[model samples]
Target: MIYADKTDLIYSLASTRARIFLARPRRFGKSLLVSTLQSLFSDGLKYFSGLQIEKLWSDRQYDVVRLDFSGLKIFENLEQFERDFKSVLLEAFSPLGFNINKSRENIVFFDQFKSWLLTLPPDSLVLLIDECDTPLTSHLDDDEAFDVIRNHLVKFYTVLKSAERCLRFFFMTGITKFSNTSIFSALNNLTDISLDTKYSQLLGLTEQEISLHFEDYLASAEKVLRLDRNQLQNALRENYDGFCFDRKAQNHIYCPWSVLNFLNNPEEGFLNYWYASGGQPKVLLNYLKKHKLANPFAFDEPRQIRLSELTAAREYKDIGIEALLAQAGYLTIRSVCSNGYAELGYPNKEVELSRAQLYTEELLRGKNLDPMGVPMLSELIETGSLEEIVARFNAGINLIDYQTFPITTEAASRACIQLFLMGAALMPEVEKHTVLGRSDLEVRAGKRHWVFEFKYAAKTKDAAQLLEAGREQMRSRRYGVGPGAGELHRAVLVFCGETRRFERWLEIEDAAD
Candidate 1:
């Protein structure tokens, strides 16, 4: 269903002479855009009813060469996958009267494609390739296999650069863009419009489009959600909005899948439809597990990166963690920072909670600890006493193998504690700075303000001394002295390295600056 009339931009794009490439997260309507283009080029204009492009584009039909690489089987080795893939490519041209196949020995695939294109008229073929990077990403785990497939990919993509004169309009879409990959090297003329301001709204749904398309649905959903029109829109923004892709950051987009699903089943009530549908994406999951989730706090804090980091072409092998998260839709531009930088954070509550759950699970499971205990902390806070909370928390930590997963420093230990707090929805801020000194963690509850100071002891007997030190650190530095100091409560957490859990949990009575 065409919710938004993006045909203007789509027409502007397809009417161009450049070979275009777009990178968007999986299920973000890339396939839909490809199908729309396929229709436009193949003279399927009847499907464009009431669309601006319906009257704009010429009715002349072209010989379209549309190749979908998403479903190719990742066979045992590069040799088998490439052989089958080559056969698929050649077979695609069979309908166009070119029956060339790999069975014709000694003729390479790209050469066969080049020879076939030479037989065609100039600017005669509209080539649209979808999921173009799947070949590279599918074999990322096997470095040797990845290199092999990447090498073959160079030959595969050369067909584009080779057939440039015979191509009418070219567009390819994928999830990730590789900088040092053979595609860019072989086909150097690709216009990467992924961050171009003009096409920023090309892939996702904008706010105005939602209202224009789903106003009636919104009116009915308002009653089901128990929210007024404004409240419902605000709620929707908090749950599914905040995706910004352009360098200028003029527009914020909503995940189309999440919004459509919410309208169909408003009773589900703004759940994390996109992330929850499949859990964490395969790329992110593999990255976190490969690193043993050493620095899970990376997901906890807002990250700042140069605009170049988001826009510049980088090899997949050398792409930054922040870039991966952004590319996979876990992170979105929060604000445009000075000095050509962008601050990135979880796009919405759904994404934030989903990340916390994923990272916490991987972090704890790596330590042989159970993840269920973390979320239980939120429930414990609502009902259980402080002592009771510690007891329950310790029960989970007892399963940790201290020898295998040692927490010898305050940082290592605090990171674990922060992960647990985040998983519990506490949203703990690490090293929250004040005029005097910094506190270990500052948590903002609605009415109550919390400052936590953590102290690590080498042995259990020294825990009490460190406990007092933590309290002194908080009091003298006035870690809890803020606008809500009246409702402020401080805690000193003393942990013993041997036990690998907080041995002392003290609640401070002092409210001082």
Candidate 2:
């Protein structure tokens, strides 16, 4: 098949011979990109009479060696994993006619391979390694096994650092960057292009790229979804639209597999392409069980954690939640603080909603349905009627078993308000470094915006007073700035308690003079 436009990454490879480290989330076409590069430089282009790389290298071809550790049982157990890996390498090079003249005994196979790579056609040799972090992550449960595998990988990669003259270019890819000097210390010269903006769309498909590639699919999609082209675009955007390689880039990209699958099966809303990459559910379940963390509905401020701290390889089964989540593609480091701290969170709406649904079901298993009080609140907010919301709140509180965890009346009220706000209100979606301050809920629908201040109280009068206070807080905080200046919308307060609480919901439109 003809390769799509990944001219940026290919251009990088062609422009320089430096060792490259490309870290992209899995199924972002890392393997395909590597394969394209291999075909370009290697002798596998016998059929490439008119491909992109053929246009550039019509006269140039070189010896290529590809190593895919992805299929290796690197996570199974350390000794067996290494032994199997030694065999895979021997088999990989044996077909390439490299001299395996030394005793076939199970010695340091990497050492033998290094000696052979040096004797190759100098700059004509390119080495590509894929899924290099598999070993480290797989053996994390077994420290001794992990250490042994880590040393082997380190020794192997470090050889590339010294064999500068023997290599034309070296490309390595993984879902996560290995911590400290475990394996990455081996290749000190490798430039990490994971966060480089130049090749942001190199592996993933941008909206423009998708539209251009599957123009035929769009017409079919529009017809099937009963949406016009623009509406179809908007629907696709809402579901799988938030991902961009550049933080500021507007070229929202969708997962290639998901898009294609949607094209193939137009009836599906959103398929689990993120999980389809494999092994995420197991990792998430493991982390959740270990941490005992809940509250997946609301967003939490990012936390700072060190790579060395994660690699300590002790306690909590030697796996850090942040590290595993980052690597498994569930969460991403949104920004790096000036103090060298990393802020991490869900990358997009697709991930956020799916994660919430999964975590909520897991944690709230066997919990009463009254815990989720948003449906009733939505009715009250949409119709400006408080009767239903009040009834639901009281019903939940009156029937509270409260045996699992000590629940304070105030805390329950706040949680009830949170559940309502989270589901009923449409929050201003923030991305990357844009800090969203704490507020009950910020809702925007069409031209109307609502800032809610919820106050749950035991008495109706106190609830009303608390509601007024919350409105004042909104005004004092300058909740919405700039564009909607003087366009202040409504501030609402909601109170729920044993004694009928008096709460007021005020409609504040853009105060036009």
By TM-score, the best candidate is 1
Predicted candidate 1 versus true structure: per-residue lDDT over 439-474, tens digit per residue: 887765556666678788999999998888887777
- What C-alpha lDDT values do all the predictions have? 0.76, 0.58
TM-score of 2: 0.68
lDDT for each residue of candidate 2 in 1-513, tens digit (9 for 90 to 100) = 324576545855755878888876666778887887787777645755554655555436777779988776434556677778777777666766665565764655666677777776668777788877665655444567767776777777766666668788789887665454345556666777665567666776677877777887788877777879888787666656554444323333566655666777777755555654552544356456656454432334465555333223233354566766655556655655556455567666556555544543443453443446455444454454345545654544344333432233543444444443433332333211213455555555445454555566665657667766766665655565446533345455465454433245554343331
| TM-score of each prediction | 0.83, 0.68
The residue-level lDDT of candidate 1 at 267 comes to: 82
Error of 1 at 198 (Å): 1.4
